[model samples]
Target: MWLTGRSIALIAAAAVSLALAALVGIPALLYVTGLCAGLVAVAVVLAVLARPRLVLTRTVTPAIVEPDEPVEVVLDVGVVSGVPVVAGHWRDRLPSTVLGTATGTVPVTGEPRARVEYVVTGRRRGSHELGPFSVSVGDAFGLVQRSLVAGGRDRFIVLPRRHSLDVRVGPAGATDGATRLHPTSGLGQDDVIARPYLPGDALKRWHWKATAHHGEPMVRQEESELRPTVLVVLDADPRVHDHAGFEWSVSAAASVVAHYGGRGFDVDLATGAQQVSLESGHGLQDALVVLALAEPDSSPLIIPARERTTFVMTGSLDSTSAARLLQAVPSRDTIAFVARGTSEDAHGALAAAGWHVVVRDSNEDLEAAWAAATGVPA
Candidate 1:
């Protein structure tokens, strides 16, 4: 490419002044002007021919960072032949989303070799590509410029930040089971009943009813049954809240799934993008890995109603749709964990449709909501 218009204009003016001085027969002026013009031309040629011999290597302190966190990017520039580098400019190419309206140039100067460090804050969650950085080298006269593009690029994955909650879920009789069984001792309507004390029963099991009628102490016994199954549905709506809020919700959902699975209940997770079912083994770690890679999307409910406890986590609910599904599967218990800013009417609608509703304002509210829905002591 040819020199820029400004460079050409300056060179032309210097040449014209030198020629006029020579024609006017001013010996001293002509000699000085010619010398100056020749110097400028030689300087411009050197600057234009000055090939950038520097190599650039970038190192990001952390290849992955959480949303809203800061990541440091360091660039090392070294001259191949030990040429003393005076002053140069470094441009670390960043994504448009990351750079926004900011300028790209990063000033660099050193004694032949140096490293430049910069910090970039992650404002969103996703994969961001860094680099194709370039280094520009020029002479002191600023007449010519030469640049070299870096060879490789770096990639960074910005994950979402999650919050924790203290909560548990299980069936009535069995601590960890696939079927919901009525508690033999609790206030509930079920076919199971308590029996009188036996000879091998402990003193704590004594019942006074048989003692008063038959003049003997009786103990209470419970009926045995299978465990209840639970399914967790996560609504990953990107437009519902900010990136941080969405990440927190994902973390809360993963915790809840882990909590229920630990208690021995058959746990299944349903999200807008994927579905995971842990029918007979512990799979919390695998489930979390899936959750980590899941991206937010806006979609309607995709979980089908079954004969099990279904926990729905969403910012909002469609009452009529939820009610219809609940009506179809009356044997299964339905719970709606409404996220912050969800309409109150949605909860009311779920309640009217014979489904339990728990509204959460933050991660703390998640614990309270889970306890209320599962009747588990927090």
Candidate 2:
């Protein structure tokens, strides 16, 4: 539905020739106008008749990736029944949420099928739709051009990055009761079961009720252990941090989730917007996706992080935001990973709330910051 440069030049030439024929009384000028006009008309007719039916399929390799991770995209192109498409240019629409070069020269051989490819990296930690791919086609004389659009859309996702907070953490204070209990049989001497007593068994192991009911002495045998639970909370207030700082907080929370979950701690993740109970350290993907799609919220950080061990990951805080953060928690063991630019009031408030506050820059080494938070001074 647009004009090409060549068509514009031809139209101009035809108009000039007709004008010259009228003023200069030259029959040759009229012939030139007729030729130019006739050629333009034929080009238009060909453009209208020569329509193409196109099918495009696209794929993103390594369906799961983190921000700035390069992903290769392959577009399979096929032409069904239509006018013979001449060799032209093809370009895929890459949205603002992604970064890549999506244009290439498309050589239309006699074959009906072809392939185009490009690489795109997701700009942020979320899912974004890719395209409604289109290509340009034109007549043999290159006087008229038309566009062919492929149907449908494709979705791509970018996950939050996880850092190895290389610190051996001490007991994360957690509650005793749990819905999903992992059996710790033979690991410790707690939660013992009564069994038939044997000779040489200690008197302390004897169960009086079993002895009376079974007509034989029954002794206690120990079995089963319970895994501790930890709650990882992310602060989503936009006023507390700039863009980079907020992103860093997200990555830090992801690291904490992975670290404890792998070591057998039941983990739960929370943002001001949503909370996901990752009981028994299962549903790790569910936690990550939440972080990926999370946005800064105006809601106060007053969600209950009642677990014995609670982690608060957030950016630099002023006095006001620090007060807001203090509202949700004063858990038995509280840890806060905060930005380096934090005000003194913020630090004092967290300490008053009994949190072991750790401060560092968004770009600082994650391991170093974690070590400082959990280990003895180096």
Candidate 3:
């Protein structure tokens, strides 16, 4: 409990009155001092008892959003048991970058429960937590106040906004219409032919009508091709990129993933030590969430030597690191988006190694940078 200015002033006046009563032997002054003391005691007791038996729960609508979108946070405050407080204060804890503060009052009447709604805008892309809510209650006279923690925290992720690119970066690995031949593997819409059944084949693959026609156990033959795969490598080492540089890299990487993944290309997202190959449907959203929360790591880039087309987005790159990348991806068929502040030698090394390199300044437009990198008209 904390004393308000009024409470402090009353206590001081009481002490002065008591001192005067002792000096002048005035009974009225003693009564005035006693009255002030009694009021303070009552206020203290009320403040102590005014701790509201409150249950608080916080929920955020659309927990995952892109930057600049507003998220509504609703705090439900219900009184379990206690005298209805005349007034109470509440404040929500939020990230410093998120706009707006949650501050309001609990009214006297209406329902035993109240909902406080506040909209918070995400200023940047990343994961954020919205808090342990704070509640304060005081006596009717507002002389003493007591505060308590009411609610647990909730997590929200602000994903990077996907930018539109006029120039199409086609799926990697193979042409759009190309198909790969496979032994009648899994059942799918692609099965086109039936041949004599092979040993150890599952009964499910046996074509019953085709077997009777061929006078033998015939199995279905299906032809399916692996989808073109695109690898997105993000360099999140804080030593190279400051906050702005890192954000740009993240945005660029997200754009690349969204672009090809939308075209039915298999997307592989890698940052720091984490790597995941995305499936169809909700897979891209799941990958973006991980990318939004990715932080800097001290490890160097570890690009696999696979033949899939690779895209590297980094704040800075040294020659040694570039050489290591060349060693892993010897085809040098990689596309590199090197952000500002990287050494010229690093760019030179990657370029000399046959990689298509895009050098971007701090303020360059993403589409224009990409156009210049891929020799496409924006």
Q: How high is the CA lDDT of each candidate model?
A: 0.58, 0.74, 0.70
Which parts of model 3 have CA positions greater than 4 angstroms off?
Answer: 9-30, 49-54, 79-87, 170-223, 300-305, 328-332, 340-345
lDDT of 2 by residue, 253-311 (tens): 88888876764466778788588877656888788888888888877655554545678
Q: Which stretches of candidate 1 lie over 4 Å from their true place?
A: 1-25, 43-55, 66-70, 78-87, 94-114, 140-142, 146-153, 168-232, 237-248, 254-269, 275-310, 320-334, 339-355, 361-378
Ranking by TM-score: 3, 2, 1
RMSD of each: 10.5, 9.6, 9.6
Candidate 2 residue 245 Cα shift, in angstroms, is: 2.2
Q: How much does candidate 1 score in TM-score? A: 0.57
Task: Name the candidate, 1 or 2, with the larger TM-score value.
Answer: 2
Q: Rank the candidates by lDDT, best first.
A: 2, 3, 1
Candidate 3 lDDT, 103-212, residue by residue in tens: 88865657877888888988878878888788776777877777777657897889987787643342232221212112223456664566443212355656788878
lDDT for 138 (candidate 1): 55
Give the number of the best model, judged by TM-score: 3
Clashing residue pairs in candidate 1 (N, C-alpha, C atoms within 3 angstroms): 177-227, 177-228, 178-227, 178-228, 178-229, 179-227, 179-228, 180-228, 197-218, 197-219
